[model samples]
Target: MTPTPADKPPSQALFSTIAARYDRCNHLFSLGIDRYWRKQLAQTLVLKADDAVLDICCGTGDMALSVLIHTPVHCVWGIDCSETMIQLAQEKRIRRAGRGRLRGKTLRLSVQDAAALAFEPGMFAAVTCAFGLRNIPDRARVLAAVFRVLAPGGQVGICEFSLPRFGLLRSVYWAYLSRVMPMAGRVVIGDAEPLRYLARSIDHWHKTVRLEEELAGAGFVDCHCRLLTGGIVTLTVARKPGPLAAQPFL
Candidate 1:
């Protein structure tokens, strides 16, 4: 059955509740590899100087910050549904600016839903989302919105958690996700439900959707997927067909 927005899980509230400890928990859970994953997604955009970028589901602005730090884009606009997450992202942007690291790049963040992006058509050179797609119920709607906002030749890069493909590693990883992750979440944040929900979401996403095929269905060309860290994470890159479609960064 096709899930509607009403079928969406209560992840936004859960994320807001853990906003303060979100980064710490992610680092702990991923062994600090989350940063590397974001970097990879950022670079996959192949952003050029003076290009404007949009990051949807831009949790805590880490993905936007990665683009600002790694690419020469003139500005990045980030949107998220969680107000707390946007506030934290704003705080991080301010901190990065104070450290004189932004190099005059701009980051504009707001609390906005990814399914209904409030922007003009073809407004950005690239779009990115990291660890955000799994929680969205109407992914086709969001991808359509993403496709509409991207300029012709623009690209989209997504980073998501996936079950490992190898048998032994898959078993070990599932154990860590299903058991250790929840226990650690309880110890660190006094909450186990969110981590449990995370495991379930990853499982559901893996079993139900093929993101690369979804991207193609949304009128994107040159779709490609790369498994990072032994398929524990997948990076999907695709392009809106145009002159730049030939120059993908996958």
Candidate 2:
């Protein structure tokens, strides 16, 4: 059975405690490779002019902003369970707007649980989540919510950490995850518990979860995964059944 929110206080509290230092720790821990991963996920969306995109678990709006900057999407909506994360995302939107980087595109962010999206059905052309799904105890429910909100033929791109298939690489990556990452998190965030949880969650997901299969079960077709950075990360892309409407913008 899927766990309730009450049963998952650690995950939400972890994010809240580290929200301010989240972006810094992310970049530092990943050696700045996460930016490229987000860009890769954004490119897979193939967003078109006037296409609306929804970003689930969009902490600090990085993934959503990447989509807006990299694609010609009309609007991007981001939702996160952590209010502090959502506030930081809003601050980022305001700063980007002040710098004229938004190009008049709309950016909306709110504190909403991924398992229960509040948006209308078939409201989005594409959906994205980066480094977030594994934290949710009920990822299947979140995928269902994503499937419901996406239009027919809408695409979904998910970026997640995974163990490398190559034995040596996997060992090395595991060491870094188990040791160096949490150590760096201690220095960056002043707490190692969240980073430790991150490592454990990634390990658990890599060993047991089949995201592509889950996507298919959630009514998505053409589900596939592409490993990046020596399989340290996986980008899973899937499409809803039916005619795809958005053409790539020139």
Candidate 3:
């Protein structure tokens, strides 16, 4: 059932309406560079056996799967509120059985909320959320929840859209996002408001420095930012305090 905007909860409706087109629309809006970001994240993340990682807002589980493929982590836990998204991810996981790569890694998929995670405290060695932090309505709560669930020294890596570094390019990108993205979205997936909401989130998001401050405020240590796609996107990495995370805990 495709939900109209009038549905009881609009965000859920919006996500449900677009699940089928979500991946394609992402590729379109990102100009196909988003895949590269995921690959880079997977490569950069250091993982080890007995490391249990959580992936919040794990839509379609692409980044989680990328992590699974790239590292020898003991397990990957993916949670998303969108049932359709989980279904798609599950299907993909099943299809990839032929690859015989995940035989030893446990990949758990569940429909769960980001702001209020169900996992036990100190459960994960690291957490990753790709293009997910913006969609969470309670950013602080989600960060706190993530902090709580992570083991001491657990790290988090977030990949998300950001304002470009250069003023002229930022202006051009913002204009295109605000003006043309919705139109193209309408043609591509029959949904414009969601894309517009995405644009607004990016437009109004805190700068990278402020984001790093927010992470630090949430008790993460040594927070830093890395610009990607010429600063059209940013990857913020932070770690929970303590020594276990000095190296991936086996």
Candidate 4:
């Protein structure tokens, strides 16, 4: 299916319609680099077995599953805005068969919006979001919610696509993401606007340094960001300070 520019949704409903194929298009369009980027983010997290993890905007749960496999996190709770995406994530969980058991970890998925999470304060030891923040309209609120839900000394990891700074590499990245990806989406999934929006959002996102400051503003400490693929993607890690304060919501 080749995507036309009109294939993207103005609201959430249209996005749900293509949820089933989103993963497929993502891998194809990114040439499988997406998984590596996610793996990098998960690795940077350095999760321990006792950690309670939350994956926001989990989208089919690839990053969450990665954490379940490589990290010692006791449980991974995945949340996504799209119910269809959650359904697909659950199906993937079933397909994994005994992988969860082998690691002694559990995977949970639910349809939840990032801006309005249903979690108790200081409940998660770690939180992650890969390639999901840009789609959100209110990222600051989401980050604050993430801060509220994380336990002291907890870490947050974010993996997201970003524009390159170097002119030549940025040009190539833009050509591939903005031009080639939409064409591929049209041919592969018969949709285009979703990828188009993806490109647009990446362009519209905060600069890496600015984003790290946003994390600090949300009460995270030792915030940092690493550029991947010539700045085509960014992996951010931040930690909650020790000596937990009572959450106002709690």
lDDT of 2 by residue, 49-164 (tens): 78889999999999999898888876899999999999999988988883445687888998999999999999999999999887787788999999999999888899998889
Query: Candidate 3, which ten residues in sequence have the lowest lDDT sum?
Result: 1-10
Ranking by TM-score: 1, 2, 4, 3
lDDT of 3 by residue, 1-250 (tens): 1223322223766777788888899888888888888767766666677889899988888889878877787589999999999998898888775376677666799999888999999998889999888766567899999999988888888888888879899888878888899999999998687777777667656432377878988889877777887788888878889885544211
> What is the Å distance of residue 208 in model 4 from its true position?
9.9
Q: Which stretches of candidate 2 lie over 4 Å from their true place?
A: 1-9, 98-101, 246-250
**RMSD of each candidate?**
2.9, 3.7, 4.8, 5.2
**Quality of model 2 by C-alpha lDDT:** 0.84
**Given candidate 2, what's the lDDT at residue 250?**
13
The C-alpha stretches of model 1 lying farther than 4 A from their native spots are: 1-8, 98-100
What's the lDDT for residue 9 in model 4? 24
- Score each candidate by Cα lDDT: 0.87, 0.84, 0.80, 0.80
Candidate 1 per-residue lDDT over residues 170-226, each given as its tens digit: 999999998999999999999997888888878878888888889988999888888
- lDDT comparison, 1 vs 2, better candidate: 1
Clashes of 1: 0
TM-scores of all candidate predictions against the true structure: 0.94, 0.92, 0.88, 0.89
